[model samples]
Target: MEQIQEAYDALAIEFAASNPKSKAAYDIATKCLPGGNTRTVLFYEPFPLYTERAEGCHLWDVDGHKYVDLLGEYTAGLYGHSNPVILKAIQEALKRGLSFGSHHADEARLAQLIRDRFSGIELVRFTNSGTEATLMALAAAKIFTDRSKIMVFEGGYHGGGFLFKSGPHPVNVPHQFLMAQYNDTASVDELIAANGEDIAAIIVEPMIGSGGCIPGTPGFLAHLREKATEIGAVLIFDEVMTSRLYSGGGVQSELGITPDLTTLGKYIGGGMSFGAFGGKADIMSTYDPRATSTARKGASVPHAGTFNNNVLTMAAGSAGLENVFSPDVARTLHGRGDDLRNKLNSIAKGTILKVTGCGSIMNIRFIATPPEDIHNVRDLEGQSTLLLDMLHLYMLGQGFYMARRGFIALSLELTATELDGFLEAAQGFLRKYATLVSG
Candidate 1:
């Protein structure tokens, strides 16, 4: 451990020396923005890189250091920086108009694409981001079920306001939330037995993102579907990051478990800000002002967002789905991720490093004797956080960019050569730090 700290200190000094321009940028930005950052995840100790430009899957920092970008903008950059197809679509939409302040043809087309893709989505509504989509999905669930309590798992992150890494975040919306253990059916069963009557919904990610990229077991997720139905609670699958895993239908479709509600964001809008929540016709009808059925009750749910149907997002999303990111492309990217992850695991076999994830998104952890399969964040209790930092700095020094938290989300634009280069660099890192990482 002492040796690991020493190596990390040396790497940090090297990183600081190499990124003086980013340091200067941080120094200047701190005066205006708190912590010199807007996104919480982008901030890291010793500051973060300020990229001057990006193209395809590569980024050039302010100091002219080039990097193969595996961060993929936290899964929102699946189309990669400057995808020509998405750019052309956005450009065409701009030529037409920006703020129509009303409905357009592209809106319905995008909604139809989403509905046809996700089997669970009978009807859909758009939002500006995944955060809004999750929030609105919860609201719809509560309204439909007429219940007060929401069941969520530890380590589940729906969005910024719905974080549950360890416990309810202070900024989280004040919903009556019931906590449960992830990938543990019995934990959910216990929660249902006690609070079944008051539970409105059970929201979960088929594979939890931003909480260590832990994939929920098939049995566990299936059990969530069964219990939610047995207790008359709505089941919501948050597929913000996982939607890209299995073409259109997501992991839920792959697992043959359909949720009552599904929330989507990231990549779906062709690298633009976008989100959507959809589900059974009955539940989604709550927002239909013109609905004559009892599904709407008496009043329609007021969901108002100016950019919900923004022309640019609708156009870009439609273009990407219809022309660029086809189902075959999705499958190829997923397979590539599986191959990359397997190679990474092979490289770390004799070390305290382990990788966990599904499809194109993954996380790296430095835990002595990591479980053959990580079920939840608790399973990673003694993971070396410092070692993860050391690995991040080392990778940066080698002209590879990944999330400081060890997250990696591959983009569609990355080539075999770029991935191979990253792997070679990773092998070099292992060789250089063999002493520090040895089990």
Candidate 2:
């Protein structure tokens, strides 16, 4: 039976009725926060499930409905909730203090760890969030190159203030962004030819996390590196979401193509708000606070943040990198993610439903037929949000939590059984909606 809108509403209505406490809380929240929501992604029709608590890959809602947490806090909960190591680190940091409001020794330790892991990152600076990291990276690029234009690909999302989906986000810092097609060397070449002289930097997420978990082609990424170096434009890889792909290293390591600068965040902070940016020493040294001779010569980039090295985040992040997401652990998580992505694609092979991603992150996409190459943003257009929402709600009813856009990520804590369960749930969704999703 093809489930109609009424059927979908019935499920949502049932979900709302069963969670009266959450609905009531939402009703109260509306008086304070807009639409009773703070994060736009968490809101859905009817209402979002109010999670009371979570441990490992499971969550309990306010109504006490237990769900397998496949969402993984949209990739921030890389260790899953309540990991003993991260929890202990947080608690211990709290006991010591929250913020010193000055430079701390632990910050250097965390920096050393990051430097040792990321081959492309020789120097780094912490930020309160990924948004800041990308923002500062761009600032440094423009200052170094003395250019006013930036080259960004469509569907590439660097941060909250650096969004370039349909168009530049209203809240985004205004920049002359030359939009290029992702994973398309020809389109990138066209943009470079048009704006190369004035382009200071090219910012890209190796995998478009928010737009879709779309991975970049190695050829395309390498081409960007070559062209950017030729034009003196800094190439910045925003690996905020993909940083956990291989512990501290990400696509740069996998593809064997390095960017001049890299921005990182998400799971790197052990589920805390964290972000970092770094690259070659010459570029990063521009932000040196030390009294350099260049200071008297009037060439310095002053970057400052009050909570850049909050003790809690520094301690938790260090512990997460050293203990939780070790190379061995990261490899296991990536393998499981590859397994789930393959299973989902195998199940939806002949249908409009297709899964696309790499490593431990992916997204479900609905189109008439899988494109011969999803190498550009234009290739991924015309996606049906209605189908995605229906599946999202259906999965939620089946005790799975996920993004409305069908994004799913795996944490180190997930087991083979849980991975199998997620695959089973996807298969079930396809079976129940087979008549509808079938071409």
Candidate 3:
């Protein structure tokens, strides 16, 4: 049998040849954006395909090749591209005008809709991205509690600047972050015991999204809630990605554990660039502008973002939350994705490939043996990425588009038939690569 590397290189050659237009686009983009990509995750070996258009659950690359969009814009395209409701809302807002430098009712409308959907967000504020939302959430915690230490789990991803793989990224804010092992209650417990008095917040994702879509163990998450509360530290749940797991709330709602502050983004904006952070009024009140006296005394965390309450984002978000991704739609889509993941896992039962995730998001890992569990980045890192990347190229050839990192996020626009097609492609790939991937 050929070495996996050789087979993958041959596949890459075919991919590149078939994507001449994307190649040209990349050549042009490289002069502007580094490596022809602004988002590092989209960068893959050889080159990445450039998409020309997307509608519903499909995307057409610049080379005119079309594929099912299983990446779902990294879980932010929950409404799918060109969703009629979202389009209509944005169009209506555009007719009125774009960003209003001043406050508007649209902000109140969107905020109310969010509050109605999420019980934990008593008072909310908007930002341009999830990165900003989490940045502010931690800020609120620090000011509200007057502490600086933060407890974060390894492999946990809050935002671009807030990533903690093994330790803080080079560009990560200079916060005093205490690293704990994801899904290991003891790691968190030990940190809380030592830093309880100095810790201001315990921030975590309900599931590690960028770190490979690993879900948090219920016990570990519960321990965080209890310890953070006992320590008088703010517990912030970064639900920017997992909020799509359900409409009423996210993994927290499923697990019945509430955090003091919840940061949000992605689908909440109805496919627009948007984010939010809010929770118990007291913690959020740290940014209360009405407290002019507090601001004068330097006690209030005065917040300002020119487009924080952008009129267009508010209209689209309000419509998506209230009209498109209602509780019923969320439940139905999540059920469909769950069914798809189960089928894929069953087909991969005797092979190196394994799938893990919750609801509509999941990841694939190839290993020599089935892992006991994969609750942290280190566990995922131990797996073989060779077969995983092969799976990516093979599936792309089969008209399915998933993340290069083995991540899959389904869109509500996908019908059951399209989902079934995805399953067939996976089974076929397993059969074709039996010699390489089989145990």
Candidate 4:
């Protein structure tokens, strides 16, 4: 353990020295930006690498070092960086206009595209971020049901909204949100039975994203849907990260469990910031301005944003969906993810490291058996964060980028040769780290 930590420390020093410009930038950023970074996702120990530019599946850092991108901006770049299709669309949209407070044709076009793919979505509303989309979904559910409480899975991250973040302290939450176990129907039943009447909805990520790339069991999801229907609570599927797993947003095509509402983002934005929520016609009609005149909030549910359907994002999103919707393209991306998972598992077969996930998302666990089957956030208690961090640093030093939480998202641009390189590098790292586990 000590040796591994020392090796990582040395690598950190080398990383810092190799990128003088990024190091200087980090130092300057610390003066104004807390933690020397604007977003928590970009903060890496010993400072993060500053990218000069990215093309296809590769990223060139400020130091001129190139690496095959596996992080994909936390799974937001499924089509890869600077994709020609997406780029051309964005350029065209820019020529027309950037933002229009009024509704644009592209917004409806994108919404129609999404609706066509996911069966549960009858009407869609756009938001600037997944966080806002989720917040709006929750608010709409509450208003429609006249219920204040919501049920959320422990590891499920809908967004950074106060309601979603209401767990153990430091989140400073003030709402009626209940935390339930993931993949355990009994736990959800318990919560619903205790507070079903007051609960407006149950929101969950079909595949846990930031909590680790764990997928919800089919049985568990079915149970959740049944319970939600029985109790008259909305079932919200947050497919922001898992949308890349299938052509049709995750739950619809992958799990086949339909929800009352679905929130989407990540790759749908085509490397831009965009999010959306939609649901059944009757439920979604609660927000229709034309229908609800003279009622409570004067129709429309008071959900509006200046940049809700920015032209650039809409164009990029449409182009991104074009790539994802192609059967061959979706198969290729999913194949790469499968190859990665299999290769990692083969490497760690007899070792302490355990690889777990589904389709295009995966995680590495230091323990032999991941606690609680990793169905939810509470199951993360036994995970080896220190060991994972060391392994992450090791991988970064060897020229691979991964989410700090060990999530790896593959892109359509990567070829077999690039994929093999990642597997080989990861095998080498695991072999080296196995010595520490044995000691």
Candidate 5:
């Protein structure tokens, strides 16, 4: 552990020295933006690199250092930095207008594209972000079921306000939350047995995104579906990140377990800020303003957002989905991601380094004697994050950009050669830190 700390300190010093411009930028930013960041996930010790420009799968930082970008803007940049189709669509939309303050044709077109992709989503309502989508989904569920309690996993993260890392955060919306364990049907069953009557919704991430990229076991997810039905609770699948794993429907289609509501965001907006939530017609119909009985209690749920159907997001999302990131493209990316993860595991065969995730998104962790299948974040307890921090700096020095927390999200513009380059850099890091990474 002392040796590892020594190595991490050395790497940190090197990082600080190399990215002086970014350090200066951070120093200046701290005067305005709290903690020198608007997004919490992007910050790291010393400072985070400020990208001046990006093209394809590469980023040039303020210090003029070039790197292969694997962060993918935390899965929102799936089409890469500059997709010609998306850019053209945005340009065309700009000519028409920015904010129409009314409905447009592209909004419905984009919604239709989403509905076609996910069978579970019958009616779609857009929001500015994934956070808003999840909040609205919870609201819709509570209204539809006429219950107040929401069931969530211990490590699950829906949005900023819906977080449940250890427990419901103080900043979280005051929904009566019931905590359960991810990938553990027994824990869910126990919770349902206690509060089934008051539970309005069961929200889960098919693949836990920020909570260590852990995937919910097939049986566990199926059990939730069964339990939700038995107790009359609305099942909401938060597929904000997992939707990119499959080409046709999503993780739901992949596992053949459909939920009552599915919240979506990230790449679906073609790199523009966007979100959507939809599900069973009966439940989603609660938001239908056309209903005649407005006077009746709970007849309709009013949902309004200023930029829900903004022209830029609708246009870019439609063009990217239709032309760039088609079903064939999605499938290809999934295969490549699997192959990459397999090779990564192969390279780190005897080391403490292990990777976990579904397709196109993965995370690195230094776990001694890691389990064959990581079902949840609890399975990764006591692992040293210091090793990941060291590796992050080492990879950055090797001209590769990834999240400081060891996250890597692939983009459509990233080529096989770029991936190969990343693998080689990873191999170099392992060899360089053989003493520290050895099991």
Candidate 6:
């Protein structure tokens, strides 16, 4: 442990000195923000890299060092930074107006584009972030079903909301949120059997995000859909991170499964703050003003936000999705991801490391081979977080940028050459850090 700490300390000093602007900015941010950063997601071992700019799958740090941006803003930069189409859309919208707090054609146009692709969505509503989208979806489920309980996968992270926080809650209302093992049909069945008719919804990430980028087995997801239908519970897919995997939505296009509600974010905003939730027409109609008895001219679900459906976000999101949904782009990304996965697996063959997750969204588990069959969150206990932290910092020093949690998301702009470069860097890092990693 001491040796590992020393290695990290050395790297921290090197990182700080390597970029004077980032170091200074980090120091200043610490005074106003708790951890020298606004979002905890951006925090890294030595300190986060403060970027001067980014363009087409590359990031330049404040000190002007360039790197392949594998992190991709937690999988949100599917089109890469400053994409021409998205940037132009944003600029065009700026001339019109930023917000109106009223109806906008762009909002409905974007909504139609999403509805056309996602199997589960007949209607949709916008929110500022994935957190809000998931929250609203959960609330809608509870209200529509008149049930208090929600079932969530153990390793699934829907956001940092109180209801989804780690551990059991004592309050009656939020306490109804129960956890089951991810990708484990039996465990999920057991939970549903125990709670039965009381469960309003079963929420899961089609591919786990932050809990290690693990994908759900087909059988497990299928079972969840069946169970939800059997017990009259709404099945919700939180695809904020995995939506990039498919042109039409992740689970629906990839696995041929449909959910009652789907929450989306990440790339949809085109690097801006955005989120959305949508589902079957009947369920979504619960938010319709036409069905309400309120005296107001237009009212729905008691939902209103200052920035919801802002024109800039709508325009940029439409542009981003247009590029993302192209068949050629998807094929290119998946091909690169497959190459990266195969190469990493080969390099780690003799070592105690393993890689997992679906196309484009992957993770490197350290000190153990992730189960030959990883069906649930509990299966992840076999890996070592300490080793993961060491590996993350080591790779960072070698010019790779990924989450300490081992999440990696590829962008549309990264070419085959860049993919090979990243693999070469990983191979070199693993060879040098093998001794420390073995400990």
Highest-lDDT candidate: 1
Q: Which stretch of 10 consecutive residues in model 5 shows the poorest summed lDDT?
A: 290-299
Local distance difference test, candidate 3? 0.85
Candidates in descending lDDT order: 1, 5, 3, 2, 6, 4
- Model 3 clashes, total count: 0
TM-scores of all candidate predictions against the true structure: 0.98, 0.96, 0.96, 0.94, 0.98, 0.92
Clashing pairs in 4: 155-377
Q: lDDT per residue, candidate 1, 1-439, as tens digits?
A: 7888889899999999998999999999999999888999989988888999999989999999999999998888999998899999999999999889998999999999998788788999999999999999999999998899999999999998999977899999999999899999889989898999999999999988999999988999999999999999999999999998977569877888999999999989998889999999999988987757539558788899999999999999999898888888998999999889988998888998889888899998888756456898788888989989998999999899999889999999898998999889888988998888888
The C-alpha stretches of model 4 lying farther than 4 A from their native spots are 162-169, 292-298, 370-372
Model 2: residue 164 alpha-carbon error in angstroms: 1.3
Every candidate's lDDT = 0.91, 0.84, 0.85, 0.77, 0.89, 0.78
lDDT of 6 by residue, 78-161 (tens): 888878898899999999987777888889888987887688888999999988898889888887787889898766677656
Q: Flag regions of model 5 displaced more than 4 Å.
A: 293-299
Give one digit per residue, the lDDT tens place, for model 5 in 1-439: 8999999899999999999999999999999999999999889986899889999899999999999999898889999999889999999999998899999999999999999888688888999999999999998888878899999998899988988877789989999999999998888988888999999999999988888888888898899999999999999999998888868367987788999999999999999999999998878887889776432355577899999999999999999888887788888998888888888988998998998887888888999746466787778887889999998899999999999888888999999899999999999999998988887
Task: List where candidate 3 sits over 4 angstroms from the true fold.
Answer: 292-299, 368-372
Model 3 residue pairs with clashes: none
Compared with the true structure, model 2 gives a TM-score of 0.96
Query: Taking the tens digit of each residue's C-alpha lDDT, what string does model 3 give over 1-25?
Result: 3588888998899898889988888
Q: How good is model 1 by TM-score? A: 0.98
Give me the overall lDDT of model 6: 0.78
For candidate 2, write residues 250-320 as lDDT tens digits: 88877778888999988888888898999988788878877373323465777888888989889899998
The pairs that clash in candidate 2 are none
